[model samples]
Target: MKKKDLLKLPSVSEVLLEINDNKYHNDKYIKYIIKDEIAAFRSQAKQGSLQLDRNQIIQSILLKITKLSTASIKPVINATGIILHTGLGRAPVGKKIISKVSKRLSGYVNLELNLETGKRGQRQEHISALISSITGAEDAMVVNNNAAAVLLSLNELAEGKDVIVSRGQLVEIGGSFRIPDMITKSGCKLVEVGTTNRTHISDYEKAISSNTGLILWVHTSNYIISGFTKQVKIDELVELGRKKRIPVMSDLGCGEILDLSNKGIPTNMIVHDVIKSGSSITTFSGDKLLGGPQCGIIAGKRSLIKRIKVNPIARTVRSDKWTISLLEETLRSLRMDSINDNLTLSLMVTTRKELEKRANKLLSVIPTKLRSNHNISIQETFVEAGSGTLPGATFDSIAFKISSKKYTPAKLSDKFRNAQNPVVGYIKGNNYYIDFKSIISSQEKLLLSSIVEVLG
Candidate 1:
């Protein structure tokens, strides 16, 4: 097989036919997939040490095509105990409710049309009532994510004007996405008020001017400033916004509904009681603490919401009907008092007794030989609700620190990580902990079985 001839890939249409035998991609999607795959192949072969046959190249292409064709947005168990693992497609929706979304997604039914009046109605109407009632926002608009919500607000309301943010709150995330960068992109001037460690009400007060269009209070969502730190309170900031006659726009980046402290859960309480607070707007994610979809929700005064609705940027950043429809369903579930039962976050934060039950369930299937003379015991351990939600917060969770007879802690941990369903865990002082809080109920047996299989 000539290398050049081998490199000449099959027609994407032909490959598509081989994979599905019925469904075919539209010309544009086919072109994009093939172009991208071919580009990747060429880049990989640039080292010149690699050789590709026509069949091998075709196999590679077919694998990608098949993966895409049968894509169903499947669920994966979060064994890392990061309750809101943003990277692993944050917030897998509840099975039953997401099933509803999937069914409706296959066909369009009145996305914008008002069924009752036989006229056009705002798509935002679907979620408006639920979001307002739930979050106590007089009005709300949801976009792709929290960042987009923040961007949309700034672009619409503070464009070509000064937006004052705390130097303390000007934090960066995974991709070097900075608060200043977002503010700059929104056509707003970034004014840093206080130092990263400590920022006071006086710092914000000193920066206000006619150009100061928005007093941006971005939460230190992921990172925390420890001792010797002082920050403005949400209510105090709302008061400052009132005195300055400027809108206070806050980004509660992580999502939460019920106060963690009130729930007797060891998590921080930072969500501004915004519905009752006389503030212009507040934004937060639907996934993090809310345990909902990855959506950015903006809720605040009706007047400010009206302005945001009319903004040109909204069209670009606003979510589709599927997102709103699913969110509405989730919100409706909450209104009906079904959210606590259905929510993953609630399921994850288990009592010590509940944790013991789950651990014992897994232990039942754990192989005898590796169970340290068959006397393996479940012990209580501190499990942090992860992915930057609560830094120091610890929840009582149960896990088996497999005191093994056969394998070392590191070896056992590695085995589970490579399983069909990855069971991520950590070890310290020769103890391996598979936190019950992280693994799903269905996954418990699988985890135990995996350990047995590895030992066997």
Candidate 2:
């Protein structure tokens, strides 16, 4: 084809005729491709440095065509059974809440307006009371993410002031976001105290000078210093702050407000109790253990919270309509007395017997040939309530281990990852470990089909 001829931005009808003449099967996609081609051609009307329009159009169309033909948002069997699988968008929102969001998104409602009086109402009011009721905090506010919450808090209180923190507590979470960097960005002077493994209250006390504005304690949620580790208690710091007339602020990273000391969670990890620890302000995430939308929630003395709210960055880092709506509903769920049954994390932490039933259903449906090719076994597996919530611990669960002759672990994983809905499972010891903790009963059939297609 000549340059100008190729540049003739094919119309829908012309494209259809060419495909028909060539006996191409995909006429349905030509309409969208032709539209993209035309848009590309017109946008390059300026004297171009390179032939940009002609080259990228076909490639863009082909990519879009592939995506359009493929299953876009189909559900996958979560045999990996990670309750809070961060990669899989964590907890699935209830159908009721999802429908509410759909209805709200379709048009505008009083997202910013109070329907009762026609006056401008606080957006946080949608969920604040519910969160307050559950946590017993005087006041609370939310931002886009936990990092933003920490940034906003540091900027508000300790800007250009010495913020005392434990050396071990200066953590680097996912994506290289370090605590010291956050403190620097917020204009706070870093005052590191004690050793990484052990820090006494006296170390914190010694660090406090007239410049000490806030004491920051960050949760080492992802790491554990098991042997010979001691740190000042949150309550102790709260007491110290009271005595010294200084404010203690801690970042309850991976914020779970539940009293998990007895719920089989690790020791002394309660957000509310820590909040009540005389800390003037407690900042945590709305996502993570909370199983809500990604948000940084700060709840504490109304006066300090008010200052943080008025800071200019609050407007910049505020939650959007969808996040606010989902978070509000999720907080409401937590406040209800009957919320235990509905909790997503709690549900994923089901016993092995629950998963065994689903596994047996899958086993019955799978073809005999594939089953014979692999040794299937149910072994005790542990699952993390991921999203950085529960670290160094796993819930007791069972998984289906399939080791095959025809396909290797990598090949099987690749097949599932590229399948219609994309299944993600772990491969350990040359076998695929499909944890029952993550899988639901309804997904058993699809899991069987996927296995059959890969190994059938």
Candidate 3:
């Protein structure tokens, strides 16, 4: 506690040697971590902000080292009912997709090689046919994400020209990405054509000029604009583009390939439907509705796709083999008509009865006494498809509400997050909720253990 005692703390060399005995592979990294912890403790001692006995110095150093060891990116359970939670890594992939992608990671196997001709091949060729077949497009290519795809399309088609877009569709979503900003960055002039809530086809007709290079229709998937709203349809825009000889493009931000209308969840323009609507090009995110890795898919007519593919920006925003492999596997599963498929998005859109069953099963795993500790109950809840998809739409789900007498909602949330595999949930007022919409059946046991550990 005294200055003299602080001066007698373990030397850096001694602490480094002690840590070296723990079998740390990198001596330099361990030595740096040990020295940094010691400096902080010494600073605190000088300022009288804290006191540490000489005997506790080694233990403190060990704790700091242990904390650093576990500070890597590890997987956590998602109980937040947000199927596409951006902060928690948008969509979850199955083990089969993981294994298939893992195989492509080690060494190499025809990543850019054509097996039939035994020559160098294009990387996009691997998934191009699958995407075209699934989306009914003449051709398709991929970029790193939807943003990149938009940038590439705009730069390649409308550079130094006019891009007509609706004022309502000039949206800014997560990560500060705005349509006007992207248009400016693409070296194109943005010609706003419609009002915020309404844009008639005549607006586009008036905006068209000799400089009009592209017509962009952005699907406001992140938020809803309703009540006296009128936007030009893709078919109408495509008809106009056909007459004017200008390319029509649609940005289906969270485009889905499957039809979920039967599940009571209304979906917007599907990728294939947009392609069939005669848009010259359509772009969407692979991670959101497709339930694949983070990538951007651009599908449309063969001529437009060919032009976009040869653009120099396409090479910079292209997807790597890891994304390509997982995407290929995901598309294959979607194409199959099997009933026992394990798609992540499909599971998130499961029926209310199925979610209630999963919730009850999770509750049954927790012992009766532990359940009573927090006064847990199975409550009907609603959750959104997070990360800017289906903004105002919420799906029916089951949530286990816990009201702890010993701890408030905040304290209980902290406890759940401190688990080995952290559990994320939602809290409203004084109650903490773990929704069953995003929690898979295999995670029920782990969720039960985390709940019991927190409340018991």
Candidate 4:
């Protein structure tokens, strides 16, 4: 608070002189950082919360510069067993896929140039035929994400008209995006036709009118209503739409292509079946179950797809070259019956026995010093198929339960997270646990190194 104390603060030039690294030598940015640090120091000193020390202030400014220069989107190991974790970038594109795509995209290719005629081309042509072949639809297209696909479809087919949906199926996806809000934004009126727990086909029949533009059927992929539930099947709705001369649209939030029932994973209406069931248009996500880059796939009748393609909003929400190339490769892998090559599908179907073997291998590698210092053992845990793909289903998994005499569970978890290559884990019942279900075989060594570096 005294003039003399204010004079003790370091000058901006004094702080800049300490940043000798070439990367941090940008004088303008460094000066800004120094000024911001000085403002905070003045405020704290005024509140009697901090002392005005020149050396400490200079060191703090240097640290801020170092942090600012580092990359924020580096990779982290996912030890949390939740496959398709939204926080960890939903579905991870496989390294092999990335390499192949990189080779083609690193330089320019035929993105919008027609090789046959040497004329302009459409980007959607890259994935449209592939999606059609896999899903058995007349045509298909890709957008930036599922929400964009839904908005484009509604704006084209149901704008200034009634969009009928069941009350039970009105759901909210990640980031607080609700179905009703999307409908309103698309310039359509949302008409709720059934009860929350029970929706009869009669309710849909009564709700249909001349103003009905489209019949919307939403799959509650995130959650399930257990008892006393009744909703019309897609076939029945399709029949009704045929009679009423209206189009039926199905929003399968998670686009499942193959039947995973034999693998103990529950089966939803796959994309192929939805189109085969006579739905005019069916939309789903490419990132969730398809194990590809984030995008929205719209597959249905040729006429409807043609109309959707011409919409002005389609141009605004179209997928870039990277998404098209990556998704095209992913779908080709699926068509070739190479499921294991897809990382997301591989993690989802990894057996508990395999996980146990990995967990045991990890347990045997812990340094003897750490083994003596920390109490670590293998335990059984349960995790789900995250990102609203498979609801009410839990898969058995193996995890390493750890306890320390000097550190609490929360403290150990924090240490793991702050390691050079972060290992993300969870804490439960006074112990920190790292599940092996989500850890691919290649990441095992890095996981061990992180453990030794933290507990050693």
lDDT of 3 by residue, 124-186 (tens): 998999999999999999889999999999998899999999999999989898999999999
Cα lDDT tens digits, model 1, 357-425, are 777767766665567652467777876665667667777777766667667888877876666555667
For candidate 1, the per-residue lDDT at 77 reads 51
Largest TM-score belongs to which candidate?
4
Best by lDDT: 4
Q: Looking at candidate 4, what is the lDDT of residue 415?
A: 96
Estimate the TM-score of every prediction: 0.82, 0.85, 0.94, 0.95
Candidate 2: which stretches are off by over 4 Å?
1-64, 68-74, 260-268, 335-337, 340-343
Backbone clash pairs for candidate 4 read none
Ordered from best to worst lDDT, the candidate numbers read: 4, 3, 2, 1
What TM-score does prediction 4 earn? 0.95
Q: Which stretches of candidate 3 lie over 4 Å from their true place?
A: 1-9, 20-23
Clash count for each candidate, listed in order shown: 0, 1, 0, 0
CA deviation > 4 Å runs, candidate 4:
23-32
Candidate 2: what lDDT?
A: 0.76
Model 1, TM vs. native? 0.82
All candidates in order of TM-score, best leading: 4, 3, 2, 1
What are the per-residue Cα lDDT tens digits for candidate 2 across 229-266?
A: 89998899999999988888888887776655444555
Per residue, candidate 4 scores C-alpha lDDT tens digits across 221-296 of 8999989888889999999999999999999988999887777667877899999999999999999989999999
